[model samples]
Target: MTETVRIATLDGADSFDAYVAWPEGTPRAAIIVIQEIFGVNPGIRAKCDKWAAAGYLAVAPDLFWRIERGIELDPDVEPEMQRAFELFGLNKPDDNVKDIEATIHWIRREAGVPKVGAVGYCLGGKLAYMTATRTDIDASVGYYGVMIDQMLGESHAIAKPLLLHVPTADHFVDAEAQAKMHEGLDGHPRVTIHDYEGLDHGFATESGNRRDEAGAQLADSRTAEFFAANL
Candidate 1:
C-alpha cells in the first residue's frame, strides 16, 4: 500500500511531502528512496513499491519542494530536461541532507525501525554519496551518480556501507571522473563500486526510454544483496 506522509523539517519551520509505500506485513527495515533531478515521480514511486513488495517500508521525499513542489519531468523532453538542470542548480545539497536526516529520525522515532538505508538515482545517486558521508543512514546505494569524483575529499566521513553503480559510457559523467572515483574510493572499507561497461545513464530507471532490463536486473540484484548484508 502507498500513502503520502508529511515530515517536518529539522528546523520546524515547515514540512515537506514524502510518498511512502508500505509492505503487506510488518517491515524488516525501511529505505529512503531518493529522487533524480526529477521529483518524487512515478519512476521513483515504482521503486518504492518494489522495495515494499520485498518487505521494506520505502519513503521518497520531495527534495525539490523548496523550489517547486511536485515536479515530475521527462528526460526525453528537451525543455523539461533543461528545467530539471535548472532545479538541480538551485537545490541545496547540504540542506537536503538535513531533510534526509530528519526522515531517518522520523522512521526511527515514530515507526521504530532499527535500520534505515537509502537508494538514490541520477542526481540522487550523488546525494546517496553525500548521505553516506553526512548522515547516519545505515547503508546507501547510488546508480549512475554524477559528480561524485568532485566529493572525494568527504569520503573520509563515510562511516557506513555505500554501494555506487557507475556507467562507464555515461555522457553526464566522463571517463576522467570515473577513473578518479575508482582511484579515490577503491580501498575504502565501507565503499563498493561497480562499473557497467558501455551502458549509458538511467539504464536502471524503473520505466522509461532509458531502462535496460539486463543492466537493471544485475544492478538491482547487487543492491538487494548489499542491503541484506549491510542493513
Candidate 2:
C-alpha cells in the first residue's frame, strides 16, 4: 500500500509530495528513493513498492516539486526530456541537497524504521551521492548517476556505504569520467562501483527501450545485496 504525504523543508517550506509504501507490519528499514529528471513517475513508484515488498518502508519524494507539482514525463519523448531538464535547471545543487535532507528527516521521524538507506536513479543518482555527504544514511545506491565526477571533488564529506551503478554505454558518463570517480574514491573503503555492460541510461526501467533484462537483473540483485549488507 502507498499514500501521498508532505514533508517540510529546512527553509520552512513545503518541499515535497512523497509516496510512502510498506506492508501491514513493522518494517526492517526505511528507504528513500529519489526520482530521475522525469520526477516521481510510475517507474520510480514501482521501485518503491518493490522495496516495500522486500520488507522495507519505502518513500519516494517528488524532488521536482519545487518547480511544479505532480509533473511527470514520458521517458521516450524528446519534448518531455526538454521540459524535465528545464525544470531541473532552475534549481541549484544546494537546493536539491536541502530538499533531500528534508526528505531524510521526514523518513526518520515519520516512517518509524530504525535504520535508513537511500536509492536513486538518473538525476536522483547524483542526489544519492549528495545524500551520503549530507545525511546520516546507513547505505545508498545510485543507478546510472551523472555528474559523479563533480561530486567526487568533495569526497571527504562522504563516509557511508555507497554503491554506484554505471552503464558502459551511457553517453553522459564515459570511461574517463568513471576512472576519475574511482580514483577520487580511492581511500573510501565503503564505496563500491559497478559497471554494467551493454546497458544505457534508464536500463532498469522496463518501459525504456534500452532496458537490458540481464543487466537489470544483475543490478537489482546486487542492489538488494548491498542494502542487506549495509542497512
Candidate 3:
C-alpha cells in the first residue's frame, strides 16, 4: 500500500510531498527512491511500490518541488529535456543532499526501521553517491550516474556499501570518462561496479528508445540483493 506524505526540510520553512509505500506488517528496512530530472512521476512512484513489495518501507521525494512542484517531463521531448536540465542546474549538490537527508530522517522516524538505503537514477543517481558519502545511510545504488567522474574524489569517503551500475554506451559518460571512474573507484573495498555493455543512459527506465529490460532487471536484482544484505 502507498500514500502521499510531506517530509519536513532542514529549516522547517518548507516541506515537500513524497510518495511512500508500506509493506504488509513491519518493514525490514527503509529505502529512499530518488527521482531522475523528472519530478515524482508515475515511474518513480512505481519504483517505491516495487521496493515496498520487496518488504521495504520506501519513499520517493519530490526533489523538484522547490523549483516547480509536480513537474513531470517526458524524456524523449527536447523541450522537456532542456527544461529539466535548466531546473537541474538551478540546484546545488548541497541543497539536494539536504532534501535527501530530510527524507532519510523521515524514514528513520516514521518507518520504525533501523536501516536505510538509497537508489537513484540519472540526476538521482549522482545524488545517491552523494547520499552514501555525505549521509548515514547503510547502502546506496546509483544507476549510470552522470558527472561521477568529476566527483570521484569523494569515493574514499564511502564507509558503507555502494553499488554503481554503468552502461558502456551511455552518451552522458563516454569511454574515457568511464576509464577515469574505473581508475578512481573500482576495487575500492566498499564499492561494487557493474558495467553493462551496449546499453545507453537511463536503460532502467523501461520507456522510449533507451529502455533495456534485461539490463534493468539485472541491475535492479543486484540492487535488491545489495539492500537485502546491507540494509
Which candidate gets the maximum TM-score versus the true structure? 1
lDDT of 2 by residue, 49-146 (tens): 99999999998887777678888887688999888888778856677778777877787776667688999988888889988888778889989988
* TM-score result, candidate 1: 0.98
RMSD of 2: 1.4
Error of 3 at 186 (Å): 1.2
* Candidate 1 local lDDT, 101-182, one digit each (tens): 8899889997788899999999899999999999989999999998999999999999999999998899999999999999
| Candidate of highest lDDT | 1
What stretches of model 1 exceed 4 Å from their correct place? none
Q: Residue 54 in candidate 2 has what lDDT?
A: 94
TM-score of each model, paired residue for residue: 0.98, 0.95, 0.96
Question: Distance from true position, residue 201, model 3, in Å?
Answer: 0.1
Clashing pairs in 2: none
lDDT score for candidate 2 against the true structure:
0.83
**Per-candidate local distance difference test:** 0.93, 0.83, 0.89
The residue-by-residue lDDT of candidate 3 on 1-231, one tens digit each, is: 889998899898999988999999899999999899977877888888888888899999888887878888877889988988898889677788899999888888866788999999998989999998899899999999989889888887899999999999999999998999899888799999999999999999846767899999999899988988898
